[model samples]
Target: MKRIVAGGFFLLSGVLLYLGVHLAAAMYLPHITGWSTPPGKYGTALRETGGYAANLFSILLMIGGSLILLIELYFPHAAATYKKALAERNREYEKKHNLRE
Candidate 1:
């Protein structure tokens, strides 16, 4: 149940993050890419393709998506480690008292 919940949250966060980055690109492109409203004009083509911002964002999204998916693949291992950490902390707390399994 916890794993399921964590995965759902991660998915939601990833989607939202991607959307925000995409929107930023749409706004920042005109400046960073230097695209003109009217094409075929003087200095009409700045990049003639895409800008650094778009490339950077694309790379970032790819890397971030891969990382998130990688982490998700190891969810079971992470959950186990998380449980062990919690157990160790609980042991420290119950040093003065008994804890029920």
Candidate 2:
């Protein structure tokens, strides 16, 4: 069950990261054209501003998604570390209480 949940998190993180990358690429297309404005033929000032806003949002999405993915990937190691610490604590408690098996 835990494995399944972790797998789901991994899948979701991968999907979000993939989408963020694609969106960032799309947002870059306008800058690459040397147009210095929005890419539409009927582009207006408002449209240009909106385009810039969308690009900013995409960048934010990319950063956030990558961070989340990094956390998801590191979760297992974190869990292991926590478990090791807990076991060590338990051993210390047993030794203090003279309850060692």
Candidate 3:
């Protein structure tokens, strides 16, 4: 129960973090990387403007965290069900073909 709730919270936090990072990136990436000049160089612009590589890294981090949390909570049952179904299908196929394993 606690794990399930924690998973839900992690998912929600990830979504919110992604949204915030997306908004910040949309607002600043153009300014940082839009032109060819010293100030517009990626490193210089990010350093001056207090910007980080938020768009790509934040999204990846959020997705990884959320999936880790949620999958840990839910994937065991799903995996077991899938394994059971596959085993049953293999058994049926073997029976039909008079094959033994």
Candidate 4:
């Protein structure tokens, strides 16, 4: 079950990351095509701002996907460690309260 979930996360993250890269490329397409020059200040500002926004979104998506993949891969061990720590803390709390069972 855990393997399946992790595999799904890996697949989803890979697709998201790929899409982000494609979107980023699209954000730069106009510049690469030598047609980036705008007719007016407003046009230039709009174009630049739009491109930056798109690129920013793409970068965020890529980062989010990568983090998801990493988390999915490491979650099992992390969860186990957290559970152990929680149990230890609970035990300490109970001891302090003189409520051992």
TM-score (all chains, Cα) for each model: 0.35, 0.47, 0.42, 0.39
Per-residue accuracy of model 3 over 1-101 as CA lDDT, tens digit each: 66656766656666776577546545666666355675455445444444455545556656766777778767988999999999999999999999995
Model 4 alpha-carbon miss at residue 76, Å: 2.6
Off by over 4 Å in 1: 33-101
Candidate 4 Cα errors over 4 Å, as ranges? 1-34, 38-65
What is candidate 4's lDDT per residue for 2-101, written digit by digit as tens? 7556556655665665566556555655654333445344344335445545545646655665666667678978999999999999999999999976
For candidate 1, the lDDT comes to 0.58
Q: Candidate 2: misplaced stretches above 4 Å?
A: 1-49, 99-101
| lDDT, model 1, position 10 | 57
lDDT of each: 0.58, 0.60, 0.66, 0.62
Q: Which stretches of candidate 3 lie over 4 Å from their true place?
A: 30-61, 68-101
Estimate, for each residue in 1-101, the C-alpha lDDT of model 2 and write its tens digit: 45446555555655665565456556655554344444443243224434555545655655665566567678878999999999999999999999976
Q: Can you list the residue pairs that collide in candidate 3?
A: none
Between candidates 1 and 4, the one scoring higher on TM-score is: 4
Better of 1 and 2 by lDDT: 2
| Candidate with the greatest lDDT versus the true structure | 3
